[model samples]
Target: MGEERNRPTIVVVDDAAEVRALVRARLRLSDKLDVVGGAANGAEAVELVRQLRPTLVLLDVSMPVMDGLEALPLILEASPGTRVVMYSGFQEQGLAHRAMALGASAFLEKSMALDDLAEDLLAVLGADAPVAPTSPLETQHPAADDLDRSILREHLERFREVFEDAAIGMATVTLAGQIVRANRTLAALFELSVDDLVGVPFADFTAASATAVRAALADILAGRRRVVKIEHEIAGPAVPLQVRTTLAPVLDSNDRPLYLFLQMEDVTAQRGAEEELRRSEDRFRLLVETVEDYAIFMLSPEGLIESWNAGAQRTKGYTADEIIGQHFRVFYPPELQESQHPEHELVMALRDGHYEEEGWRVRKDGTQFWANVVITTVRNGDGRHVGFAKVTRDVSERRAMLQEREATSAALTAANARLQQVAEDQAHFLAVTAHELRTPVGVLGGTADTLAAHWADLEEDERDELLAGMSSSAGRLRRLLADLLTASRLQSSALQLDLAAVDVGAVVDTSVATAQRTHPGAAIIADTERDLVVQGDGQRLAQIVDNLVSNALAHGVPPVVASARRIGDEIEVAVSDAGPGVQPEMSERLFERFSTGRAAGGTGLGLYIVRQLARAHGGDATYRRPEGSEPGAFVVLLPHSPPNA
Candidate 1:
């Protein structure tokens, strides 16, 4: 008791309620120092300091009403013997110099560790300041004059303002979980007025977070943790709130557990934003993987493959696993590699920011195909060259289709003897085109008419089937028009790619579902892994897959299997049927426009479109005989992108 009286009484002042509470708790750790009071603003601090005339005052620079700089002189004048230490989170050189010029004993940064803060505080107070009495019985303290009693009363009054006016949820809870003192914010949290919350158990307010809060409190009391910060749902007055809670233990002068100080901050809005951002990323990733008309990939600065997207998998013959970390030169033909064309392309891209060319390139099977290659320089945030973005499209089928159209046009203009046959061919071609366009439209129109005419006579199941048929026909018409427009763009050399990340597996699933809807009788099985992402356009990739599946179902027998799988660095999707396979003689002309077998309904252009779409994505569509059987199989292979690339 005698030593407690002799200890040098100190006052802590900060704008932050938490900082003030922390200072009080920390100061009480040493028997030589006693925290008399705390103030939120400089105005209150000046009054408190004047009345208390303590040994030292820890003053924060930024405060409302009056700042530390403005109140420093007044504090000094009010108590000539008191020492003033200026503290803040800011590390401004001019502020530090000005604080010293204004008679501050020390300028300490608020970011200093607790141990450093204690050492700096003790150093600033000086060794000559009052020390604890050596013995308990020696109660005679000549250092404390009659003026100290007046100071004690002033300190108690200043503390009352801080305890009641803090904006955050603050409370002093007993070790037994009783709330001895709580501010307006804490009471407001539980929907009660401050006056009515005097003896309420802290656990009552902590409905959902009761267990967590009690455990944290116990840890603090047992000295296991210095501070506990956790996010918990608190039962507020009007509604439940997600809050960040902090608990700190207040120790007595003898280093024994005394009370608990809690701070709560509502963070419900922040958590919602985080969840929304995660969902947005998922949507964007889906968009990127659905592409299938262009090969999109990334390379390291040294021209090594870094990322391969779905379009790349479709266009290139490698999967993400097989291609990543390997040099991009793997896609070049032996002649190009020997001539160092790949290196030259990189050099050109680096110099010009981009390089584009159309030439022949080798696929994984060493088969040569015509491709349009575009390489663009990639840079880091600092504008330094990091790598390159490569986009490639296999234009072989498009070139072939255009060439055939031109040849047919030129033949009609010349060869007068064959002009009659040419006109007949033209008429037949137009008829086939009209039939393809009118079939789906007619189905849609007839279904609508039947439903309108027999509204009362049709059963629910029949009506549903008719409505589904109309929808299916409408979708089919839309797809056909899209294919024609794409073909027209290819003929005019106006086809362009809009590349992004796409989920290959999702695109395959959509295509398989569409097939099931269109051909309800066929047993269409889809076997694929989820999250097989690649760089491509979703609509185009779906078109390619749908075309192949439709072709297999129309030309082959039942039990069609559509399977997609990752093969090394590439992705392969195969649609297999159990019907008669492609004749060996027609293998060379199978993908040619106007080259259909004895299929009853096609315009002879479906296979051509499928091949073109696959080629455009830097991939190829192939017709093969199923292993150990005469049945046919249609397959498309695409590339996959690396994770995080």
Candidate 2:
């Protein structure tokens, strides 16, 4: 198709080579319009229009030498029929209609889309399009909205003038997330040219920020989060901007969010102030809470209760509702009621800062809790006293517990004294019994040995009877003496440890031989391992082993087992037998003096003496029922010490 003869010829003028290239390419792509030529400055563009005689001149407002604002008249005078379209940047703030009144056909922003540019050019060249008069108002009339729109447009133009010229950052965005306007303030903030920023999406300026653009959009869309006043930090090509955003909602006539008005103020100083205030409050709260033993409360200026915590209720024994607003005098005992002068204290807190005292205060049930009171005045930013903060504590419970513990300790001391007295008495009785019986039993045991030796000289039957009688009498005397002597030593307060290394095998061997002589007819088995050593007095240790073996033979039916072995660093002397095992009652009292196992007849000092001597030597004695013996086992243990010990 042949190009339409009436299509307007357009000339492009700009200082940037890129601007001339873009406009020329975009305008040339149109079938109806032809891009005549291009220039890098207003002077060149003016000469191009005169030489080419194009239908229209697309003039850039900002250029070197002669600016479009200055070249407009010249371009029109050179070609009077040319429809001049003034191209401006986002930062080109002043209204262009005044220039249009001179000769220009229309105004276009440099950031407009290529397609939009084509459409605008076509619309401008259409027949019957409205021509520019010397003024806008003298040309037409419109309804209320358009009239309001015009007035708002004027306001917007004035705002743009200030934004481009002022030394601050600013922008205008619609609720639908569109960049409706911008100025040099925003261009400098984003480190971009005015034309580069005008039509670009707000998100593009903050493309590196993950949620920065989305967050701003949410503030515009969400009704509840409207007017997001954030001290946002945004990074641009040059530097990071620490900006305080005061976002305001500009509502339409229907009270709907239409325009998001954002005013940015740098508040790095205000941030420092808020942080200090927050830290101070945190420290104060920490101090108050750390008063572990005190009940702190806060009251309003009129003395109305504002808060009560666990301590307040515990110390005063009054719930929040019961005594929150009640007069503090309720806690003061009647005696100190007037002397305390709580009202005067409050007045002092209001005038000065704090009032501190220690006294007795009554609880909810009329009992007195010793209290330490501190009431301080809280103040506001203006330094006017706001209210009183009170701290109180109950020391009564602790005092009572301490007294009870002291009483218990005294009772325990008295009981201990009584036990000592009883022990001394028992000791005296045992000592006397042992001394008295020792002499008589020693004589009897000697006589029995003599009679047994001389049995061969008597008649056969008479020898049997004599031996029987002597053995019975001697056994009784020996048991009685042993019991008394052991009991006496058991009650004594003082004891001595003669921890010396002694050969355990030698002791067991000697004890078994002694039992053999003591009970000739009894079957007593003895076995001692070699080199089994222990720490104890040799004499007392021998006595301990002898007692265990004799106990086994007397109580055991027939077979008595005696063995010695090494266990860890100690020596174990075990005596077991196949006899009536120790009963439950016998097992408990079996070691008690004068309480022999049931069915056994003895003074019962043997086990008692053995256990005491074992403990004295830093060892122990134990009885266990052997598996096959049908009787319990008895083990006498002694610890082995160093050879030098």
Candidate 3:
């Protein structure tokens, strides 16, 4: 009980349960130190220190809930007399100084042996604790002299084992720069055995870095520097090797440098990797700078232009000196800038990683062009939004071509619709023509048959009637055949006009006589003004008049009139009747091929042929109607004969 009361009390704190257990067990070996309690982390240790008020706290630097640096002042505030010693795996001198500045009693590495660790903790508590020797050989030997020698031999052997078996290259050099001792790792770096390396000058391994290595060694020996570090290249079997070399003085008891402790680590692979990364960045920058087709640049997170490439300068008509550092909104039109669209684009890109669109963008000269643009969020390795990468391409030509294609497609569709309507109309005309031919053909066949069967037993009047029927049928066939042939010629653009000075009044009178004979009881009139002449084909002109008069007699109430008069520089020949002419909707289509226009019978080709023949003579055909119960007229207008003609 008295020994326990005299011993210094300590609380062991670590994040690892095994470390806490090991520390507590090691404190028992000191016999002059007592383990009062154990805690897993700083927060728990703080509470434990407050409760027990232990003389010393073995605290870990890193822990959950709270860390040692934070808990150090709290623990001391809780127990003013308690000393806290920081334990960590790191051996950095800056961390040690920082811990000491934070009022820590001492900073010890976790790599320290258990016996040394207990002694360190006890020293922090102001207790002079003699820790037991770890070797069984020292324990078994009771005599002081034997124990002293045994311990000295054990320490030297341990030093030798550590020196020869280190992973990095290690060597012991004389103050004069000669290699006194070298480990197998160090020998392998120079591609030689330890026996060959000893007694040789360390500078002899590298011709280029020999002077630098000697200077560093001299500095350590002269006490100007306690440690020296440098990166240098050494000759190798295949290629040159890079090494990080550190030199420190191995001091004697008088604090004078005895020899140099050398440490070298192979860093060739690390150097190669850094060089490759730099080259890759250079290549990327060159590619972006030389591109002329696309405007690739960078923008800050606030939407200000950060970088301008050559491509951006060429495409935007701005030099790098002129445009860099300007707000990216400058590329937008005034309306978009006023609406803050450029700012909104950044927000959207940040949210979704990228934003892309094709729209109008303004250039330096204020001209607008269609551009395809992409804005992508740029992030750092830590995933923080840094800026944006913008790529713009002008696509105005492509857009114009697309619009032209769409317009051409619409025209083709309309033409196709008109062709389809014409085809339907022609089919209907063929069916009507077949019906019309059948009536005439049947009439002629029956009339002939009747004459053949009844000739011997018939009266003269019956025979005369049969002969008149045959003549009418034959005239009908001749008219139908002529109209068909003329229509075919007009369709094939093969119609030839005979040009001459034609008497329009004479053509009208002749057409009227022919129409009256065909209709028999139909009332018809011919009215004319004298000296109405036109430059036209006379036969075609008469054909035009005849067809109009015949159409009026067939489809109109009687008093069908054919009239010719001079109007300005043209002659007008008109055919009109008293009947309601045609329905209002069919007025425009009156002269279309196969348009019968309310006619009860007859082929629908007369007016179509009339307009075609009229247009051939540098003239036109039109329909005229006066309002309020007035009659409609099909009028053909022909140019007046030239003065010379």
Candidate 2 residue 406 C-alpha distance from true site, Å: 8.6
Off by over 4 Å in 1: 1-168, 236-238, 251-257, 294-309, 324-645
Candidates sorted on lDDT, descending:
3, 1, 2
Position 6, candidate 1: lDDT: 68
lDDT of 2 at 602: 51
Candidate 2 ranges with C-alpha deviation above 4 Å: 1-479, 493-500, 585-589, 592-601, 627-631, 641-645
1-645: candidate 1 lDDT, tens digit per residue: 443356667889887776677667556643557788899888998899889999989998878899999989999999989999998765545567778899999998765544345556778877654443344322465443233333434444555677678887887778777788888887777778876767877766677888887888778778898688978776655777777878776654355666777777767788888889889968866665666888887899899988777987877778889899999888889899999999999999999999999989888888888999999999977999999989899999998998899999898677765676557646766787788778778988899899999989999999998898888888878777777787677657687767788888888888889788777777998888976777777877887788778887877777888888899888888888877677777777778665673345576667777778778788888877656654567778877776565
Using TM-score as the measure, name the better of candidate 2 and candidate 3: 3
Give the candidate number with the greatest lDDT: 3
lDDT of each: 0.78, 0.70, 0.84
Residue pairs with backbone atoms closer than 3 Å in model 2 (clashes): 624-633, 625-632
lDDT of 2 by residue, 1-645 (tens): 955555567888877676677567646644446787988877888788889998777887767799887888988888888888887763332336545676778888754545457668767777443332222332343243344344434434643576667666677776655566666766767677777765656655443552665676675677666567655665565656566655556654355665665555555567778889899989977776555567888877766667776677777787888987766777777866667577777888787788887778888899877777889999988988788988887767766787799999999999999788658645654564565456556656765676668756768777666566567557757655555555576668344556577888888888888777767877888888887776678877877887888778777766787889888888788888887677776777777655563246554578888888888877888888656624567887878664566
TM-score of each: 0.35, 0.34, 0.49
How far residue 185's Cα lies from its native spot in candidate 3, in Å, is 3.9
Comparing 1 and 2 on lDDT, the stronger one = 1
